[model samples]
Target: MPLHPKIAEILAILPAPPDGPLDPVAMRAGEESQVPPLEQRLPLHAVEDTVAGEVPVRIYTPVEAEAYGLLIYLHGGAFFLGSLDTHDHIARNLAKETGLRVVSVGYRRAPEAAFPAGLEDCYAVVHWAADNGEWLGWNGETLAVVGDSSGGTFVAALTAMAQDAGFDRITHQVLFYPSLDLDFDVDRYASLRENAKGYGLETGILKAFNAFYLDSGADPADPLVSPIKRADLTGLPPALIVTAEYDPMRDEGELYGKRLAEAGVDATVSRYEGAGHGFVQHFSWLPEYHRVYEETAAFLDRRAE
Candidate 1:
């Protein structure tokens, strides 16, 4: 299928990335400043900023919901750039569509906090939600975790950790075009070459992102850093893995889903034919973005029931 007309238009208007590496502070500030004031008018019952397990978080509660499941959402920013503010609209939309309380976490970013710290913050927030979600209107046992890009990397690592710790609080995980394998052989994935450019995220920039997120002497082989390297994928929560046809990370995300299914985990893969990475965040301009939310909500609703 051809690219969605609106998506093509968006691509045409997108400014080229900086000539060199982006300053993390400037990138974060620029992204946050452009976030439309869409959260205030979202159909959610309430939106609040609070601390969960010492991690900053934004909670979105739907007006028409009751005793809903809770979702701990981590935003996509290559582990170095995103904040709750950067993904506020995405979180609110999820809350409104799924009737699930969405907790968007602002985990510690990398380069400053580095590897384990950000992952630990996200994991802590989930543990906190499991124990204290009732105060936020969650009366159901159903709990889910979701993320995009690097955030999805966190979801994968958190699931593995929770499973190892015998924590059964999370029932489902949704990963959107996730970078599951830090050591992924780029030459093996054709998309890395075919869609490396003109798709918003280039392969070189992604490599830089990984470098910024990893410690100076960190081993990318660690399962927590690269879940695809894990020897075991069994006993993890059901997963809904999404990918974009033109995304550099598409193959790895799809492969992860296949690995989960092979390990007897319930995993579904949805590839958007005309979409690119981060379409969910660019929902306003991409026609396929709504499908991402609809498919996600349906998956969550089924698991919750």
Candidate 2:
């Protein structure tokens, strides 16, 4: 399918990335400046900032929603960027749309804290939420995890870790155009080439994120670093993986869903036509933002196929 007409306009109007190596720090500032002011953000029931297992997290509660379960959100920004504040509107709207209490993790970013550091923080917050469900007014027991881009990488690895660590608390997993595989150099997926550049997230920039994400000696192919490297996907939580038609990350996300279903996990993959990476974040031009919310609510509620 061709790019959405609006998407083409978005791409045309957007500035092209620098031709050289992208600096994580510079990119962070550029992206952070784009966040809408608080008054312009969605009106939620109540939003609070608190610590969950020593990790800072922002909690958003929906108005009169006491039945829906709690959700943990990990925002996208490759790995070096993104924060609770950067994605405040998203978390707020997610809670409102899904009618669930949302805990947005402010995990440590890369080129500073590195890989496991961020992942550990996300897991710690989940543990804290499970232990303090009553205090957060959680429905209890039903805990779902959602992430986009690099954060989605954490969600995938965290599920496997939770299983191995005997933390079988996550009931559902949702990934938004996730970068499941860190091995970006491989030609394992066609979208890497088909939608590599000029569709929003350029190929060079993505490779740069991959380069900065890992500071350790661990290979990019490690299962913990790249969840797609994990051979056995059995026993993982049910998943709703959303991928965009023109996004470079599309193939791995869809493939992950296929692998999950093959491993007997209940997994559904939805490709939003004429869309690309991070389409749900933009509300001014695309309706996919609301579609994401509706789809997620239905999936989390087990009311959709």
Highest lDDT: give the candidate number: 1
lDDT (tens digit, per residue) of candidate 1 on 133-164? 66877775669999988899999999999999
Q: Score every model by TM-score.
A: 0.94, 0.94
* Clash number for candidate 1: 1
Error of 2 at 292 (Å): 1.0
Clash numbers, per candidate: 1, 0
Residue 60 error for model 1, in Å? 0.5
**Residue 246 shift from truth in candidate 1, angstroms:** 0.3
Which portions of model 1 show Cα errors greater than 4 Å? 38-41, 64-66, 216-218
Locate the minimum summed-lDDT window of 10 residues in model 2: 281-290
Please provide, for model 2 over 24-130, each residue's C-alpha lDDT reduced to its tens digit, 9 standing for 90 to 100: 78888877899888898888878889888678999888886555588999988877788888888778878987888999999988778856788889888888888
- What lDDT is reached at residue 144 by model 1? 94
How far in Å is the alpha carbon of 154 misplaced in model 1?
Answer: 0.4
